[model samples]
Target: MKGAMKALRLHKTTQKIVDGLKLETVPIPEIGPRDVLIDIKATGLCGSDIHFIDGSSILPKFPTILGHETAGIICEVGSEVKDYKVGDRVCANFATPCGKCYQCLTGRPSICPNRSMIGVTDDGAYAEYVKTASSALIRLPDNIPFDQGAAATDAVATPFHMISKRSGMKPGDTVAVFGLGGLGIHAVEIARMYGAGMIIGVDVDDYICERAKKLFGADEVINSRKIDAVAEIKRITGDGVDISLEVVGVPESQLQAVNCLRPGGRALMGGLGAAPVAMPNTGIFVRREWEVLGCYAFENLEIEKVLKLASAGRLDLSKTVTSHIKLEDISVGLQDLHQKKGYPIRIVAVQD
Candidate 1:
């Protein structure tokens, strides 16, 4: 707990991912007065981590650790950290928001203008040890496994926000999820949890669509490559979906998600990419009264609800973890995810 620990790091000196990522031993991070040192039990590989490797604007610093969706056991706590103690099981708020900021004070920490994210702006959980403010730590229940805890941090939390906050999903509402990637798949499951009457999962990949139905309990699956997604969605639902979530950051998919929403229905956009989406027709917003809202991550209180659900056995975060590997294989996992080699929802790295 005092000396160096094994870590997967991306260095500025080696910009290319293949040449840059390395398994190295680094000093275990120390905690400040209000911080807690966590002995990482499991960490998830997310798409945003790739941005760090690709030198995106998200990565605020060079030579930073990358895995952000994580869960661990508290190994050490600072003098001011009274709520948590050593041996406590927990997952952290990946975004470090200034508690005094307007967004934070207004109960919207996810969109805090002055926030620093783990992995992107700070040393993250790719290492055996991580240090975070005690305020960011969310207590984990005894029944939940570390891998599921890690996945729930982002994969589950992101969709929770998309459905609950952005779309105001309600019971009996029909929902459509575009893209069957990790986040999108969870959107399908969480929409179901929201008591959606019908859940549709759309993806170009046949494998993903099948997994969405069999694994995530999607009521219907659409292979967009073979059929007109918007048309199919309209045919399935009498008018259109009550709420549609676009999880694939492509302009076409964004358009499809909005087009499939019924009049007065809302759409949640959680995906991100370089391509810009053209504004929808004026009538769609003006006459139809359709709503499109962008969602970031989950709130701290929202994550607590998810963790509690997982603890009560009401939520199954385990299904989202498709693979479990060691830290040394982080690069291989990242490559597999990048190339879409395996139809993985979430790949987690576990400590041996």
Candidate 2:
């Protein structure tokens, strides 16, 4: 744990992943009193990593590692870390919330202003070893593999939070998920798990739409590019869906998600986009009495719930991972993800 480790470091923001990230031999991270060192076993690539490379998201410092969805084994523990010992299988929540903040006191710690994110604000797990506070660790069940454990940190937990907590999804409610990417596909499955009467998956690509219906739990799929998705959804459901989730950050999809809802319906916004989105007309919005809610990352307890679902065999993630690549091939994987190659749901980096 003391020697040099190979890591993908970002020294500056660039338009391309290859140009921004360099695989270098750097010293392993040192642990503090409340910290522990994890030997990273698997890490999942996310769209936020692309945002970092394209300069859409800026890092506070230069030369930091870039992966946040991670799972690993405890290699070393600090002197003050008594609950966890070496060789414990665990996955970490990227956001470390300060327990005393106003957000934490009110039971909403995911948005803690003083929270520190693992990949965005600090060095993360795109390497062999990562240092994290013990408080951020979640126990990974033995039944779950490292790859799925890594994905559970973000890809699964994010949508689960939006649906279970923010969307106010009741059993038998009709649901529509816009954008069948990693998070969107899981949204379909989670909606079904929550006893949704009908689940529709919307996307611009035909391949993902097909996969959403065939493999995932989507009852119907719509190619938004070919036809009017809102009209088709209205046709499928006589009145419109009771709940709609906009997982695509584009303005068009956001508008469609809102318009596809029934009166007094809820629209949960889970996607992250930089462009400004125009709200619907005031008269229509007021008449419909629609509720629009913004959902951020998951709470720490939500990650545990996702893991429990995965462990119980209720949530099938066997087909979630599209491909597995070595740590050195992460740049190629990122490029394929950015290009939508093979319509990958999730690309993971695995260490031998």
Candidate 3:
């Protein structure tokens, strides 16, 4: 605790993600009297982290330690820290809410007016140790491994946030999931569990599409690249899918999902992409009363759902967790992640 711990800091001079970064003699961060010091167990690589490397996050500035989907063990606690103590395995939620805000007062803390996210609005994990508010720490079940907890934050949680919260998919509903990557594949699984009559998986990779059904138990899979994905989906569902979850943030996929909707279909568009494209206004007005939704990060974040899903064996935890690397190998991990050779769901960076 007295000596400095290793950390990867985004270099300010060249705006680059330099690995083997060090904080040779950094201080143990001061507790806010309500914060707890966490001995970071593992951190997951997110597409957003690549944005930080490419200098494209909407976040204000750089020189930040970049990681959000992280889990750790509590090493120290401030006087005001309650319900948590040293040695508790926990994960951090990105949306830190101010209790006094109008949103928080109305039981909507996720959309709190004064929200500051780690890794973007503040310094974050990607270090040996980090500090977070006691309110942010959700204890990990003893049965869960840190490596599994690492990817639980978003890769697993985002689908729950979208399918249930944004899309409002219910039992007996028919759902369409576009772009069967980390979030999309998970969404398909959730759709199946939610008792959707038909779960359609759409992706450019036939391998990923096939894996969606084989591994996650999705009812049907479609390759958007080979066939007219929208037309095929319409043909399968008679009119269209009841709910379409768009995980690829590419504008074309967004349009394609919307175009493939039945009357009153809900389109849940979620992912990390900035490419622009146009959508037809009348598509919703004429036949389908479609809800063109925009989903970013998870809202009203709950760590338990992701863990519980894994714990209950509902999620394909092992299949989704693709790569594991030590802290020193982070840079190489990021590069390989960008290439995405085999459609690994979560690339976790852990300690030796």
* Candidate maximizing TM-score: 2
Report clash pairs, candidate 1. none
Off by over 4 Å in 2: none
C-alpha TM-scores of all predictions = 0.95, 0.98, 0.92
Q: Looking at model 1, which ten-residue stretch has the lowest summed lDDT?
A: 12-21
Off by over 4 Å in 3: 12-25, 283-287, 299-301
Residue-wise C-alpha lDDT for candidate 2, range 1-352, written one tens digit per residue: 5899999998888887667689999999989989999999999999889988888877888888999999999999999999999999999999999999899999998889999988888899889999999999999999999999999999999999999999888899999999999999999999999999999999999889999999987999999999899999999999789999998788999999999999999999998888776479989999999999999999879999999999999998888899999998888889999899888899999997
lDDT per residue as tens, model 3, 1-352: 4557777777542234444233433555666788888888889887777766765556566567767878888888989877888888888886688889887898667667688777777777777888777887777878888878877778877888787678887788888888887788778777787788898898988788888989887888888888898899889889988888888788888888888888888888787686874476884546556678776566534557778877887665677678888876776677666677557777888874
Candidate 3 residue 88 C-alpha distance from true site, Å: 0.9
Candidate with top lDDT is 2
- What C-alpha lDDT, on a 0 to 100 scale, does residue 228 get in candidate 1? 97
lDDT comparison, 1 vs 2, better candidate? 2
Q: Quote the positional error of residue 283 for candidate 1 in Å.
A: 3.6
